[model samples]
Structures are given as C-alpha cells and as structure tokens.
Target: MLYFDESGYTGPDLINSKQPYFSLASIRMTDEEIAQIKEEVGYCEWGRELHFKSMYKSYHGQKILDKIFNHPLMDNYHVLPSFAHKRYCIYANIVNILVETMYHFNGINLYEGAKNLILANGLHCFAILHSNKDLVAEFENNFVGMVRKPSIESVANFYRTTDKLRYDVDTREGFFDMLSEIPPTIQYIKEALTHKKFYIDLTIPLFSVSIQEWYNKTKVKENVLFDSSEPFFANIEFMESLRDMEVPETVVGYGKGKHVYPLPVGNMEIAKSHEEFGIQLADVFASALCFALTPRNDKFVKYQDKIKSLPIFQNIKLNIAPSTNDFIEARMKETAEIDPLDFLCEHSDRININKKSNI
Candidate 1:
C-alpha cells in the first residue's frame, strides 16, 4: 500500500501569495519498514502527534528528518515527491480547460503528444512576459471563480478577461488564439473538454503524476491512501479513472518526457495522519520540501541546499514553469503549425464566435 499527503496547498485559489508552491509526497512502506523509519529518525514522543510543523521547529526534529531521509529505507523508490508552482498551475489549467477548448474548435490535436503541456507552458511563459500583474491576478481570480462554480456569468467573466490581453508572443504565435474560439456557453466548453476523461482538479495532476512515477518504477498497481483533509480529497473518483484509463501498449516520449498510462495505480481511501504512520511521514516529507522551496520567511530559511538536495530529492519530479520555448523552437515551421495558434493569424474567417456550436 502507498500513503499520500500534501502541504502548502491553498486549495483552488492558486493566486494566494501566501504559498506559491504545493507539494504532494508519497511513500510505500510496510508496518515493519515504517517502524524502522521511526527508529532511525528519532521519532518524537512529547508532541500530541508527529508531523512536520512541530518536528521542524526543534533541533531534534530537524535531526530526525535527516535520519529519515538518509535511512536505507528511502534509498530505493519507496519515497517519491512532486510539487507544482501554484501560479503557473492556474495558467496551465486555463490552457488545459479554456485554451484547449479553443484549440479543439480549430481542429487541432490538443493531446497528440506533449502539446498540452507545451501549450500550458506557452501560456505560463506568455503571462510572465506580458508583465501585467494586475491583469494576471484578475484572470486567475476569474478562472478560480469558474472552476469552483461553472456558470454563464463565470464563463463570460473568464472570456472577457482573456479579451483584455493586448499583445501576443511571436515565438508562440497564436498562443492566445483560444480567445477567438472560446465558447459563449459553459456547456459547450464542458462538453468539448480535451482531457476530461481523467481530468480532476488542477491541483490533482501532481498527485496523478506521482502515481505514474511510482508505477514506472515498480510496475505495480497498488492501493493508495491519502490524508482525507487534503484539498483534492474530493477528486477520488477522478483518481480512480486515471488508474483505469485505456492506455495502449505504445509508449510515448522519452525519459522524464516519457508518457506511460493506465497508471498501474488505483483505489483510494482517506485517513487521519494520526491513524497512519506512513501518511505522517509523508506529511514531514511534503512539509519539509515545501518549506525549503518556499519558506514562510527569512526566519525559517536554513539548510535549504541540504533539504533540497537530499539524495531522494534528486529523483523528485517537479512541475514548475513551462519548457515552452524549446517546444516552439523545435517545430521549425515558418508559420504556426498548430491550429488556433494560427487560427486568426492565417486562417481567420469572419465567422461569428457566438454562432459556433458542437463545443
């Protein structure tokens, strides 16, 4: 069985400046193995419970983390960590749900390869370059509103927000072209969702990604458990679908870029960390990693390199800013090869957006 936990999650409101990064840590360990971690890490006895916050505040607890991380138990693939930049995640979600819808309308292959990721990163990088913090915030806020409660007004607000963008990226030409194809009705967009087959909350992708990482390493479809209190607790069904996705024998991409499917992972239940030692450990791993990446302030910043460079950290996967530039450069096309990006640029027609149907 595998245990899961999360830290630094600000729920669906990713625009929160409080914590820009969110981490989900996973560990596969038997009761005996868990006991070994406790023994090696000098597990605390005085605290009401063993978790990251209390453990990290004291010297003894910090020392315990070191022991736990370096213990032979973690030497293999037993412990896996993954995180996402909250700010970029919102933009990527916009691309995934909104912009991807736009691409679908223009007859583009939205999920043919790594295009979804590349497109998401495309928006991520463009937002950074646009240099309009207020605008970005407004857009994020609207997206959050839409995801929480989808409606015509929310959809209209989101679409109107995109209309506010005044410029475009030359390298990722037509990246913003989704604006042109954005459906006026929320139903249309929902019906035409690009990856809704297994789509969960924007926050859950890292969770799903972590499962794939474990599956790739162990080739096992195992039962998983999560701290019920986590933000993505509501997406249990979606998690199951990811595990049951109909992936073909053909694999795609290479190395970390590689894509494996049907995830070889399924079944989920929620439990309080107090009842599960592995989840408690996951808490420490997630909290420690998140604090290092985004410390509360200068007062908490120490041993960042040691914390970030732990032997296990080397194998940890990250979901941060986009690798979009390389994708666009590799295309080597004089014109935008993907539709929607090149939609209005070269294939523009005077068709009215509101009149479009079939999502």
Candidate 2:
C-alpha cells in the first residue's frame, strides 16, 4: 500500500512566493514496516501528531529524521516524489495563454475590471485579476501576436532547454523577474478563489504523473491513503478520478512505459487521524524533502546545514537533482514535465478546467 502527503502547497495561487513549490510524496510500505516506524518514533503524552516542521527545530526532531533515514527497513520502502516549481510553473503557461486569448475578446475591460467584466461577459468567474490598466495593455500589445493558447498537444513545449533565464542566488531583480512571468489573469483568480475547484484542478496532474511512474517501475498496485484534510483536492471524487489517468504521449518524460501505465489504484480515503503511523511517516518525509531543496541563506541556512548530516541527505529515494541548471534538470527524476496548459487543454478523461465552465 502507499501512504502519501504533500508540502509547500499554497492552493491555486501557484505564484505564492512563501511556498516555492507544490510537492507530493509517497512511501510504499507493508503493515510490519508501519508498526516498526511507529514504535521508533513514539508519540507524545499529549498525543500530538509528530510533524516534521515543528519537530525539526528541536533535538527530538533531529532524532526522528535520523531514525527514519537510518532505519534498517529503509531498503524496504520505495519513495515517490513529485513537485512543481512555483516561480514559472505549468499554470504560468495556461495563464499566459488565457491572458493572450482575453485580448481577442476586448481585454482592456477584462484586465482593468476583470472581476466585474468576467461576471458581465457571461464567462466563468474562476478568479479575479488586479493589475494597472496601462501595464496590462502594454503586456497584451507586446506579446499577443507571439502568443496563442498553445495546441492541446504541444502546450508543454516551452523555452525549457534553450531559452532559459539566469538569476543570482538571492537578488531583488531575480525575484521581480519571476513575478513578472506570471499572467495577470492567474493573479486575479488566485486572489479571489471563490471557486475552490480550481485548486483541485491544478494539483491532481502533478500527483498523477509521479504515481504513474512509481507504478510502472515497481508494478505495485497502490491502495492510497491521504492525510485527513478538507482541501479541495482531497475529496472522494478527485481521489477516485486518479485511478484512471493517462499522461499525454507527447509529454517529456512519459516516453513509452515510463509514466504512461495502468494506475491500478485500490481503496483510497482521507485517513481519519494522524495516529495512523503511515500518515505521520509520510508527513515527516514530505516536510524533510522540501526543507532540503528550499533555497537557503541567512534565514534557512541553519536548517540546510543540519539536513546535510542526516541519513537521508542526498538519498536516491529523494529524487532531486544536485544541480538544476535547466528546466528538465529541475523536474523530479521520474515525472514528466509539468505543462498545466497541456493538462488543462487535453480535455479527455479529465475534469474540465476550461475557462468557460471553470468561471
């Protein structure tokens, strides 16, 4: 069976800087391994769930990381990691196309008074956009000709390999460039999340692509259990839909038998409580994975330094490349390139997230 959890998620607002990436991770383990992990990481007297974030600060937390990483049973667990770089994620592509498309339908009103116009124009009010009119007009006029809602088949084909941007480790210019890449339409919808379904729509494919590879390689029929939460993506219908999904054939990493395989998903549910040891273990693994990859400086360097000494430091199961100089380098080892537009535009065997019905 598989126990899954996520970290660094900030809903549909993929551009949120506080969360650099939306990541999902899973550990495949048997009942015996679960009991062993529980006994190793004992519960507190208050019966609080052993979360990695709060614990990583204390000695006990370091000990927990050590135990999980060094446990003799480590060889028995197979890890699945999937994530999206928030700075220029797949949603950035979709929002870019959507903004360009709005221009054809009189984008001035949509950009300036997007919320009101979206409501008045009889389009889906998925989210609201807030930008200065002059700036939006400049953006539209500059790129409208070069931009079109990419064909459903080739949406993931962006400037990944050749045309890439460079940035200093920590600089104001770098930060601003990342923000400028996001389309105004995405900003509006993310801020006014009146419809929670958009968040669900954006995240499922990230998980699906990763889980598909895990199944393809290991041939494990997964019976998934998610940590108990009321987030839009954790709903019963969404989890069930994961059972039948096919990554596009043209997708980057899903060449043949890679991420394009049968999902043979079994029973799936939100775990009633974190007392379930598998969920807690997954929580720890997910949090630790994020902490290791997150940028480090004055504020987070200490955590990064400490993480280097852990048994899981550079563990093959973690799947992050040592250096991510290019777009393909940034992706998880086994997952396909994240093309949110392609996922949204495919419109086959997926919950439709088209702007018309989405609003």
**Which candidate wins on lDDT?**
1
- Over the stretch 139-165, how does candidate 2's per-residue lDDT look in tens digits? 332222123222322222332210121
- In candidate 2 the C-alpha lDDT for residue 12 amounts to 49
Collision count for each candidate, in order: 0, 5
Cα lDDT listed for each candidate: 0.65, 0.49
Off by over 4 Å in 1: 44-48, 167-200, 241-262, 318-320, 324-359
Which portions of model 2 miss their true places by more than 4 Å? 42-47, 90-92, 95-202, 231-236, 242-258, 296-300, 308-359
Q: Over the stretch 262-345, how does candidate 1's per-residue lDDT look in tens digits?
A: 446767888888888888878878887787777544555656666877866664544555554655455333222233223322
